[model samples]
Target: MFQGFNLNVSNESRFDSPSTYDEILKSREDNVRESLENFYNEEGLLNGDSLRKEWFPEIENCHVFISHSSKDRELALKLANWLYHEFKIESFIDSTVWGFADKLLKQIDNKYAYREETKDYSYEIRNYTTSHVHMMLSNALNSMIERSECLLFLNTENAIRNISLKEDREQYTFSPWIMAELQTSALIEKKQSPNSQRPFGSLESNKTDIESIVKRAKSFQMIHKANVEHLNNITCENLSEWAKDCNGEKGYNALTTLYRDYAPGCR
Candidate 1:
């Protein structure tokens, strides 16, 4: 499966080599930087500021932000790894640090302990409703979405559901984090280009949630009708057919297709 996805097969060797997780992450980061540099050099824009400016007028940093439910962290990581190795496209998933931090915060009540230890009335002057940890997480996630060239939402039935209640009908809500990322991406996209037709895309093995989410997004003017594609609709009987149809001639897989739709001029 890894070979079919074009991931680094040597990862098995590395796993056997006793490398630390931090070391693996560092190596991946270095590989991404090298790949991007090579891409820029091949395009003759490595040293030409003006040429680079013209080539990427709107996109400053080209990277994909993968938004998925915490329950699907492993699947999200697999997709991100495939994206980096196969397409040389940098992808970001917040679970690496966010999940760890969240777990640590839950394990230790340091924030509340600090508040009690200080007892400084002036500290209460802070206006945020949520805890400091949550505020930091929200900021970090919003920053990632803002910096990303495209937001690829991994749609699962668990992540999104249709609420039939009248109160919920007025405002469509998915997983809180997913909703935040989508809204943040939409805000950034609108700020950058108010007239952009589609600011994001979604992928799902099932169509029910995708259709509902897309409809809700369009009703709120977050995404365009033509921007989203149902991946299951494009499946094929054979591998070659799958590659040709699902993965386009230029190798626009489900994720890359979203990036292309949002940023046409981006490489």
Candidate 2:
């Protein structure tokens, strides 16, 4: 955790004396300042390639990847923690796992420290635009998705608003990162053998029966309205269809249903 502010470190003797407590607090503040300075000097700025190589290696295994907008980081973390506690499922949230990106972004925004007129600011901007930041981020995300068993997209209001489907096209054109992750998950699911894993049910199960259930799900359209236009070209077998099937009007009952049907063993 980043610790640049004064810390509340208590000792039995210090707690009895206000002056001593104040002195301890001041000491902690000094230590924190020194640590922060050293951290910045060590990490440097605008070194995406080196950061990527050192920080994000590779995720060999994980149960799920929670996809959400940066705005909903708290909610995403809450969900990840809950999933791990309830079902013993390991999950990845970018804020925690890929925190170097967050730190770099924060450093960039610290105008007082790295003044806009300084060469550091120019170098930072140039690297953000021309360096391997995007590529590294994409690679890291794809690696996580590739290793995970499934993706749990947190469809909160913020996430939906950020990546709302376009009316004109049958494909997602906004929120490139979310769209890319979803497409990657779809591709992974497609590559898996139909008989190998049956999270929802047997692929050989009655097609007519599956279609009937899907039709019923679609009937809830009034409550859970999605961009049907975007879903037109997607096959019935696609996981996207499962998401559409589970969307209810208010809460995520439909999402629960989708998970129950597809990833049955998950809590």
Candidate 3:
């Protein structure tokens, strides 16, 4: 991880509308779909190495990794487009990879886990496959975060909650994915992102309650403490200035200043 930002965004935020980048997103999805098609052989079986390579691709130059709730995917796409338009920055949006993962799982289940007796996929097989797929996906995501120069996590009420825990207040996120990313950002080796010249870069369960689970399910189920204290908290106001400062020839200088202020002694 080079640097991380917990960017507060909401429905009222400028990034809410993705219409501006609809065409670009369509093109991107099409490209990804086509690339995935190559992973299937004439027998219709997926190549293991190809599939693994899809999950863990080589690090690219000058990219930004946008970490946001899947619910905020449109917003993330919009932000990605905005970054490209304003600063010629590319972004690694994992949701694209996630869609591929879902497709891959369906293919795997349909081929091997389906049971004629049950008229559905085997629960045991599904669990087994899911475990392997999720584990690989988690590893791939961490690899990207470590490789990217900066990580901007979209922080919204949709993803986090403030809970009253005994005498103290604590922040938590229901998404295990968010928890994992935050933890990774906190622990990963920090190095200057090539894209700072360039661009881009969970937990637990178990419990023994019914009413408690139901109430929390609608809002804060399977919570993990939000580990954003290590990140720079950025608001829309800060984003606006960052955008202005990143224009034209000032872009590199502006980023250098930002790194200097936020990450002293960092190259």
Top model number, TM-score: 3
| Ranking of all predicted structures according to lDDT, beginning with the best and ending with the worst | 3, 2, 1
Better of 2 and 3 by lDDT: 3
For model 3, residues 125-211, the per-residue Cα lDDT tens digits are 988988867777788788888876778889988778998789788888888888898899999887755545443210112223433
The collision pairs in model 2 are 199-262, 200-262, 246-254
RMSD of 2: 20.6
Candidate 1 per-residue C-alpha lDDT over 1-267 given as tens digits, one digit per residue, 9 for 90 to 100:
000010112121221212222344544333322112333455555343332222222222335666766776765566555445444455567665454334433323333222443332123433332354455566767766666654556555444544546454322334556666655654454233221233332123434754575488646523112112212121112222323343533222444453343333333
- Model 2, which residues run further than 4 Å from truth? 1-50, 102-120, 123-130, 162-174, 189-260, 263-267
lDDT of 2 by residue, 1-267 (tens): 000001111221211212222332233223321112333435465454445544454443455566765776655555555444334445566544445544444443343233434323344554554334467777878777666544566444544432334553232323556666656655553223121243321223344654675489555611122221211121223333554454432122333444454442434
- Relative to the true structure, candidate 1 reaches a TM of 0.46
lDDT of 3 at 64: 60
* Cα deviation of 267, candidate 3, in Å: 11
TM-score, cand. 3 vs. native: 0.77
lDDT of each: 0.42, 0.43, 0.69
Which numbered prediction scores highest in lDDT against the true structure? Answer: 3
lDDT of predicted model 3: 0.69
- Candidate 2 backbone overlaps, count: 3
